[model samples]
Target: MASSDSTASVPDLPSKPPAWANGSPSVRRPAFQWAPYLFLLPTVGLLFLFSLYPMLYGVWMSLRTTDVIHGTSTFVGLNNYLQLFHDPQFGLSVLNTAWYTLTVVPLIVAGSIAIAVFLRDSRPARLLARVGFYVPFVLSPVVVATSWKWLLNEDLGVINGFLKWAGLATIPWLSSDFSARVSVVVATAWNLVGFYMLMVLAGLSQISAEFYEAARIEGATGWHRFWHITLPMLRPTILLVVILATIHATQAFETILLLTDGGPGGATRLVVQNMYQSAFGRLQPGYGVAQAVVLLPVILFVAWLQMRLFKQEGVI
Candidate 1:
């Protein structure tokens, strides 16, 4: 009777449901919500002012012939593009760029993969080796090209000196057409391999150790493991590297400019270099812009083709 009286003395409290549960609005939003957009205004404004404006201007310029002397532009339709088809030099530049892409892309992929695999371990020596390989990537392209130019000099280069020391005949690395092309290819690959190695390493890091453990349990050898597991898992990364390398090779200009300057009968002349010469050296802005416009489609097509192939293989 005493416990019942104590319980009855407690006051009864009223229960209320939350606003959201009662189907009423829970959050009271501020009347002024333009803060986020205000923060993004500067970036959006700069992109439109610089990138979009220049691209639109370039397209307009491509359709018109500009007189540099009088600062006047005359609309010429697609005549600039039409003339590019019959220009032998333009054709040669395209072929050279194609060759550079075909050669350098494979070399970079193979070399970077090999290096990344070898240095995948976390040993001190491996870490040092990784740093050594990546150092060249951080250097300026101009500095790298200049250094290679000195090293590949025909008469007094370090490589020729070594060859002479070994009693072998010296080769003209930058003088002959074949050697000049080879030299340029080698220098390009050397400059780029380290950066791609980092990409491969990043891909490797994403692979699960369980896959390797399962392979080992199945008695798979190192070669079998790499072939069946590593390569398959790295397909997306390899595709990315391939596309980037192709674009780099196609637009190659600065290194070739400083190293060979498209010398030895124009063996190393690339499309970008050709465009640059036309625009600046020859003062044909319309023709140069046309070349750039044409190149855009070609690069997009090649990249699209790669993605398509990778999709068919179930890689991407």
Candidate 2:
């Protein structure tokens, strides 16, 4: 009777075996298992369509001799690239681009850093100043370029007018090679400084107030604190800004077009302008695409060089 009672206390098992008994899986999925992928599909599709496809197509086009009028292309392998190596105009454009980049990038970085440091305090005046600096960045490139052109006109521009009023000789501003280069650099830097200042301000904000407090307790002056503490902490942000500025300077087009139009004997024509003329103006699409393709590696090399330098300095 005891044994039967013990047996009766045990629970009965179902007659059917478990789902896994016959080597079939029994894991159940949630109803929303694919919801994340479903949401991501649209973004992925758009990227593939717009970004990836164009890039792949451009590379393909770079290898061919494209006749835009006839809508035909012939495989020319690396001939277009070879042709570019011997092209003097292309070489000149590359040199001009380098000079513009080297000049404007430093100016942008320095000016932005100075302005950002000045405006770090939360005073109302500083806030107003910040807004004033950033206003030009938000304006359309066309509008900014047009305004600058008026200001820097050779004879009747506002700046020359002021020079005359001050009993000083007026500058050529845009008519001469040297002055045209200076005008473009000044205009580009002025237009971009505010945007970069905002970036630096963000970097400044990320630094802890405790740092300044600690430095003050150590009898550090303002310059010492900036040099030792602030600059060291801001390295990563500075690196990012430099790389971006380099790329922007290299690819500058529309502003140069509107301001100088590669004037004073193509003094301001950049690589992109050369590429534009090759593809559309000269009807050599393949050659133009080749220039663009080569530019990608140049940009990548610059960015990589920056990364390496920063790494050596322990910035990253």
Candidate 3:
């Protein structure tokens, strides 16, 4: 009885496994507490290398003046930045890009929303219409630029031929500075409007149709329904479309490079063209980088303001 009681009273001691049988101790973080952070390492590294480093390096380069061949760089403070203000060409580029953004942003946003609203629930339309609209987005920019260039030719182009046949004189589509700039805006809209429309269509489709049906029962006119129901529902998507259009407008390079080359004497040139000229034309790589550096802050601030609008619209 005594031996049994003593055995019952003793707690079971845990035994350690043989060291060789189990394996060596591994220094491992707890999965629940630390595994997520471990998984995030690669993402952090990518952002740092691809996004952060280039931007920061551009800023550093922008603040310095360096010869292309010598590879020696010296800090020039704000001289390069001041040079941009003094440069007439830079001013023109900024104005042209601003005008481009002004033209495209409103037209694309409004046109896309209108088209999407009309098409999202479109029925009994030919399948060809959908394909035709979406096709431009898939086409390579080079192809679009080349095709437009051919069509807009002053002498032998189809557009000019049609105008002549219609008893109208040929307009200089790509000749005069004013006309050329307007042409780019129209071309950009032609190429991009479909893409924006599709995005708006997706957003509109997410909204329930029952809302409109209910509004119908309450004597809402077509315009009333659109203004009160459609516009409010599409606020998020409209905001997104505008933001994206702004970024695209600001970064517009390929079409401009191929089509105008920022020409008719820099009248239609943009900041990116200026950067290219700085880096490659003048071989002042650092100055180009500086312009980019100065531009980024402005972009970020605009993006932030747009995002705040998103927040107000309950998107973010």
Q: How far is candidate 1 from the true structure (C-alpha RMSD, Å)?
A: 13.7
Instruction: Give the Å shift of residue 148 in candidate 1.
Output: 0.5
Q: Candidate 1: misplaced stretches above 4 Å?
A: 1-33, 300-316
Cα-based TM-score, every candidate = 0.82, 0.81, 0.82
In model 2, which regions exceed 4 Å deviation?
1-34, 301-316
Question: Which run of 10 residues does model 3 get worst, by summed lDDT?
Answer: 2-11
Provide the lDDT at 140 for model 3. Answer: 76
State the C-alpha lDDT per candidate.
Answer: 0.83, 0.83, 0.79
Stretches of candidate 3 exceeding 4 Å from the true structure: 1-43, 124-130, 305-316
| Residue 120 displacement (Å), model 2 | 2.0
In the range 73-150, model 2's lDDT, one tens digit per residue, is 999999999998999989988889889988999999998888888877755645575578789878877998899999
Q: Is candidate 2 or candidate 3 better by TM-score?
A: 3
Residue 248, model 2: Cα distance from true site in angstroms? 3.2
lDDT of 1 by residue, 1-316 (tens): 2242111121233344223322235645534456667899999999989977877788889999999999999999999989999999999989998888889999999998998888776555455755787887777879989899899988889999999999999999998999999999999999888888878877887788999999999999999999999999999879878888887666457899889999877899998999999999999999998998888788779789787866765555
